[model samples]
Target: MIEAPAARAWPKSEAESLPGKLIIVEGIDGSGKSTQLDLLHKWLVSQGYLVVFTEWNSSPIVRSTTKRGKNRRLLTPMSFSLIHAADFASRVHTQILPALKAGAVVLADRYVYTAFARDAARGVSRSWLRDLYSFAVTPDIAFHFDVPLDEAIRRITLSRAEIKYYEAGMDMMLSEDIMESFQIFQGRILDEYHRLTDEFGLVPIDATQTLVKQQQQMREIVQPHLADIERVEGGDLAEVLRHSGLRGRYLQQPVWAEASE
Candidate 1:
């Protein structure tokens, strides 16, 4: 494998080395995504890597737009998809690409695959959805946390008392039919993810394990990749976790408020 000198942040060159990789964890909203991210981030850091964790809809700008779209009563599937695409664009420019160039091992909770799967589920033209995310830079690893749709729906219900307006309005989206669609949706994106793996040779970590097992499996999966992880010589998962700043209990601060716009 030929590893070149690391790339610089776009439109500028400080000659900083950026050999670290991007790892993305993706699933439905209620999946234990943040927990796994926290575990992985801390573990990578414990291995002595410089790491950072961010998410789509992270910045205030994206969150504001997401909230507005979420509250609308009659959101067409396509309209909702546009919100996600815009959110992805903001995050790519402001977060993902910058950190990749800086050489930090950046972990993302959700990404363009979300746009692909969710929009395709919503009956959007898959070609157009692909085009919307065609600008996304590839990740070194993208892990899809697979789960039963019924279980996912149950988790979402336990967390939120009411569905978002669009979720509530679509009878098809609310039915087992939709759950079955997740099977098809998952297959399509997994195909895409597999193509990504064949092309970039990504790491895949199964997410069906219990919480403890998930953490352990993630560590095992990432160890070999640590070789490509500059400045991070070893992949002691615990050490990597410490580097990411999310080792202990996480408090979800109320980071979003109504936009005055």
Candidate 2:
């Protein structure tokens, strides 16, 4: 039996090459991304991986888009679409790419698919949205948390306990008229995810399981890649991880700490 070898710890930036992995967590609003991310982060750390967890739209550039969601006003489909696309672009350049290049596994709460689903649902052209995101860094792995609409709504409602502005009244858009729109849009996003996986060779996990269970699986998926990443990018990895620790060197994206306010 040819069993896979165990993972090893080594300094980065001493290697000739490294394959950094990008793990993206994706789902509609109210899905358990936050919980899964927390669990995944802990598990990855346990595995000796330098895991960095950040959420989409949490970057400074993307946080501004939340203004539209909170304004209780309907923006022109095109305007809202462009806003998120720009947000995604800034995040890719500022936050995601740097971490991936440095060799840390980036656990993103949401990603390109958010733009695919949200924009298209508002009657925007999917093709146009794709063009906007053409410049974003694609993930190495994208996990889609599948759940029934009602279940997702329930989960989101419960999650709103802290009352963040983005989470507030998001359920108001769940009327039956829009429910179909949500499903149709969500379906398209999933389809896009499948296509992306096929084209880019991404790993997708069924995340409907409990957070503990999901994260455990996440560990399995990511741990296997670490050894290779280290072997190739170990030297560079150490440097990037080191920079990530120092002030202003790692976080290319503006941390949306204000969003929690």
Poorest lDDT segment (10 consecutive residues) of candidate 1? 252-261
lDDT of 1: 0.59
| Model 1 CA deviation exceeding 4 Å by range | 1-18, 167-206, 232-261
Model 2, residue 187: distance off in Å is 8.2
Candidate 1 C-alpha lDDT tens digits along 1-261: 222222112223222344657778777656677788877776555555666667766666667667765665445777778877877787766666655665667788876766666666666887787667776776655666665555666776788766544443342354445444444444444455444434433444455678887766666665666686566454443344444443321112122222111
Candidate 2: Cα lDDT at 242 = 56
Give the whole-model CA lDDT for all candidates, comma-separated.
0.59, 0.56
